[model samples]
Target: MNHRSLFRRLLLAAAAALPFALSVGDAAAQAALPSDRVLRVVPHADLRTLDPVAVSVTITRMHGLMIYETLFAWDSQLRPQPQMVESTTTSSDGLTWRFTLREGLRFHDGQPVTTRDVIASLRRWMARDVVGNHLGARVTALEATDARSFEMRLSRPHGFVTYALGSAVGQIPAIMRAEDAETDPSRPITTTIGSGPFRFNRDLWLSGQRVVYDRNPDYVPRREPADGLAGGRVVRVDRVEWQIMPDAATAAAALQTGEIDIWEQPALDLVPVLSRRRDIQVDRLNTISTQAMLRPNSLFPPFNDPRARLALAYATDQAEAMAGGWGDERWWRRCEAYFVCGAPFGTEAGAEGYARPNLDRARELLREAGYNGERIVFITSTDIAPIGRMAEVAAASLRRIGMNIDLQVNDWGTVITRQPRRDPPDQGGWNLFVTFASGPTMQHPLTNIGTNMACDGRNWSGWPCDEEAERLRNAVLDAPEGPERIRLLDALHRRLAETQPYRVLGQVDQPYARRSSVRGMLNAPVMVFWNIEKSAR
Candidate 1:
């Protein structure tokens, strides 16, 4: 049977076994916290790292949103709005900007937040985040003007200063304590202290099993109501517990029995079963589509050759890949646009021949690249259902095009940790991996980590180095938002097509399932526990 059929069979079997699974011992019940005061959720992945600046993974980013706060945040309209900053001023030349912190901001350790902490946090974030790096390049100086204020002097007029600081995608600009922010950007900080509405319970953190957060009573939320990731972050629940459940059936059963309040990303195949129940509400919190891609390591052989990368692109069938993993066509669509389909910059500039599958052409390209059956190591996360399915589909497609594939499966945490290694495939390196990001994150060239083809190794994990692509991307960034910018974006898209930095598999909308009792959930790209209340069932 085909992968889609196999997935359907497995899902049906799981649904049939749901009744038996409900008898299993409950992990959340063991906690002493009151059910009404606690909001239990099955997170997308385990919280392996606490330092958000060091890792760009989604789970860590979500964790940071709970305990940390940013100077500014993206509102529902995707506009930058002040979160931590009370007031701001800009020089007439637009080369310098000053910001004053809001009053009553204190870290979880009971220390007042100051400008020094903001400076240190931004400095550390600048060394790691893609957008932060761009902001750092134009910044001449970032100094604390007073105990509660800071100023950033730019070498040139930067248009997206606030946007970069308030970005809701990828690695967020989470403000940290001065001492904790002093930690090297390359190393993960153990300290979890932050000034957000929730405090991470480090004592209750059980690595791969459970992660807990307590509401911070001392948090001073903005007066405005919650909008996206901006405005007031009111914590209604006394505690938020992220209970990790790798199995989709077990998680579904838990949600059914009221053992869990929410399942962040439910398996698409089982959505029908969950939706049939009135007690469970399946909602697509993020309206924007999530773009899935196959990232190939350009630093290694096979994919190192642009021709080989093109071969994989030609071999990929967007429709087949989407159906294999995402199942329902209602949630996924074939999108060849590298900048995300339906976005303003989204275009099929040069994706005519390669976007659709051409097995004969793929074989020809592989032969031209002089591939001699070298094993291509493809790492996948079994914990994330779609990722594993995408990897399986991609591996099968590569094999049909005569590529030797070595598929390795691991949990989401392990996959993320191993993705950074630049060693050879035999020495813990990976040739390809399947992952997805929100459309907002992939919409703009600057915010799109996949489009960052900087020759420096500091780019995204794939390490795709293309001078021409880099030049085109920089041109797009510099061009004003109009015909000129659109022209440059088209050029960049065409160049990326030729270089094949990464292959866009498809676009999908993954919904979150929650018990009807879980109320006040915000609709943002990343999950936020704040502004959520666990009503008595």
Candidate 2:
């Protein structure tokens, strides 16, 4: 056999041998468990890393939600609500903040959830998350006051501290045990201990195959009714199993056969077939739509030049990109706004630049910028269907703009993992990549990772540096939430467009499928398991 075939066989053999290596009890326990008590799901991607700081993929964040608890959480109405925190008090200057934990909080290991744990967790999160980093910048110190209370003293008053703790966006400040939380921010946690509604089953974790989570019976949910990601998080199912099915057809078949309870993200092409099933119910779950984006690396040539960036922006047709990415006409919308299209801060500022595809204008601009024949390394992920299609459309557009293209295709995990590297393209750096996030995640400046225009080239994957955009972003944070704040946001949007850090392709409709027997699923963007009950066929 050829080397490739032999490697494939060896890999498959190793995967099959993992459960056995863990111990025969692992496989037997999984098979012997009652199916009625377990909720089987096919997540969008595999649960590779447990540390929220190490990775921030949607699926990883979903897993973090299942295994960890935060101090605050966003409600259905997009308001911050107390989750683990009992009450928060801010001094008159808004610089001193005190938070007390709710009663009877305990980690999975039965250790009481103390203020030290909370402080340590937030400290680690502050080093990684953008919201946390911003909050940390103004903080003088974070200390544990009492057994259950923590204090945050800031150098200056900042209004987004409470919101940052409970943020549902990228790198949420998930609380963990003090020891586990003490792990270096640069490294993943050694333990998976958390105080969330579900307890992660470390023994049953099989990387690309399956991972198991049992209901945390000791978890003390809040007295209030469950909202978006806040309030009560009562676990209805006894256990939850995430079976990673890389093939869309296989997952669809599993869902139709009632072998799985929910499919976090079902392929659009197979939605029709799955919708036809009598036992299946398919519906769009995200309250706010999702926006696809093309992020250009500002450290590299071609994209680094504003004229070159504008050339690509002018050449891109959101309608065509949406059509290619999301096939159905009803599945996507042409949104040119930087913020969420239907959100409160949504404005058409700078949208005129992306109104249409002007190839002639794009070519002329490229020529004026002295377009050197620099190779553009475009990263694409085949594991995620929508992203793959979007990358294809982007590649076609760039080629048409007379640019050299080196399209590198890999899995979603690899794409995200490589986007952070700052090496030259030939030495593992990337020129561009396509990704997407829910509208709610991008609606507000506090949670939006895309709009962070840090002056130092130490921002998100693209690494775009614009001091004026950063200043406007800070201005929005300090301003009260009103029309005045929105005006500031519009100005920020215009500057961001001028900098060309990233371009929004369009908005897409994300629909999830579940068995008719499953009920009480929240209408939120993230795939939540709490409050959802599953019945046997």
Candidate 3:
């Protein structure tokens, strides 16, 4: 069968199995809650981890925002604004900073938020987050002066201190309780207590089926109007239910039937059908586009050699890959720049030769790298449509260039859990995978986790250790925000192109589908459930 026919058949099969997939208890619970008071959504993926600090997955980050509040948060303009902090002061030398917390902030457990929790949380976050590590390197001391205030003394002046604390990208710097924050950063914490506007109902949580959250009655919102991730987080719905439906057709059917109020990410093929419906509104909530990437394991063979990585880059076609993954020329664009295409630091300095696929050039590079048909294990997620399609495109390109690709398909949760393993590809480890990041996360050298080349294995999953790249990155960070900074960024970009830390496949805009009854939705980089109301159908 053709691709379209096969896809239609799969959707039909999935729609047929929807009844068996949903439990009777789940249906009964939906009946118990009033339609206007409950906001039912089909999330992008199954939430595998609860602790956002431990795993950098997008689902955990969304879950973290529901329960936890950051000291600072990015506004609609991408500028840092105080979220939990009442006031802030900095020393004349710019080395010492002090912050005070707003009163009436209490966790779900009914305990007051204090500076001890903030300090402990920052300490743990600094151990994992890329931006946190940069700030941690310059930290002289971080101490809690009183119950409501804390002080941070740095060795040198850092310009993006608040930005690091308020990052909404991968591995968010969410503040937790002192006891929970004190746990080891390498391990995931089971406790789910925070001071955000919503409270996670862990008791009613059914793995792979449903997750629920109730509005916090005692939680105090900001006085200002709601913006991006900043301003007041006013909760309108009594409860938010996350119905995990792996099949796109099933989720789309539910949304059309008013069984679900929102679908986080509907399959691209089904977008046109859903947009034609009067009750459903398909819109792009995030203003910025997301860049898709192909990350290779730099620690293992084949990919360990820069030539092999470059061969893959030369073989893959960005337009073809993006078309296969995103489906529709209007939503996707080819981006060769590592920092993102239209950003300030975005430059395709050394990416001239690898824009389009050159099979001869790729074969030449593979031969020069002494390749002997090594088994390249490419891991993908079937639950996430774009990722799965991107993997297929990449694998096809690699095979055409005479590479042995072993494509392994699994759920998103299993793929994320397996990405961290450092074993050989023949074992449980992976050789490559396709993923995407928000445009804001990839706009800066410091904020982009993929560019980090920390040799100590403390970096992102694919550990790429390059001392020169690290030096250039540090230079870019220290430089002033002007011509000098841009020059340094270009140098860093050139170096990254040579090393090939990760291949930039393309950029695409993803839209969320919500019913007409769902209102007060905010436009942000990531989805937030607050400030939303569900009208009775």
Question: Which is the leading candidate under lDDT?
Answer: 3
Best of the two (1, 2) by lDDT = 1
Error of 2 at 110 (Å): 2.4
How well does candidate 2 match the true structure in TM-score terms?
Answer: 0.92
lDDT of 2 by residue, 147-227 (tens): 988889999888777778888887889999989888788777757889999999888787777888999999999999998
Task: Please give, for residues 369-464, the per-residue lDDT of candidate 1 as tens digits.
Answer: 889899999999778888899999999999998888999998888899888789998999999999999888898888998888888778788888
lDDT of 3 by residue, 441-474 (tens): 8878888889999787888888888999999999
Question: Model 2, stretches more than 4 Å misplaced?
Answer: 1-27, 368-370
Worst 10 residues of 1 by lDDT: 17-26
Q: How many clashes would you count in candidate 1?
A: 0
**1 or 2, which is superior by TM-score?**
1
Count the clashes in each prediction. 0, 0, 0
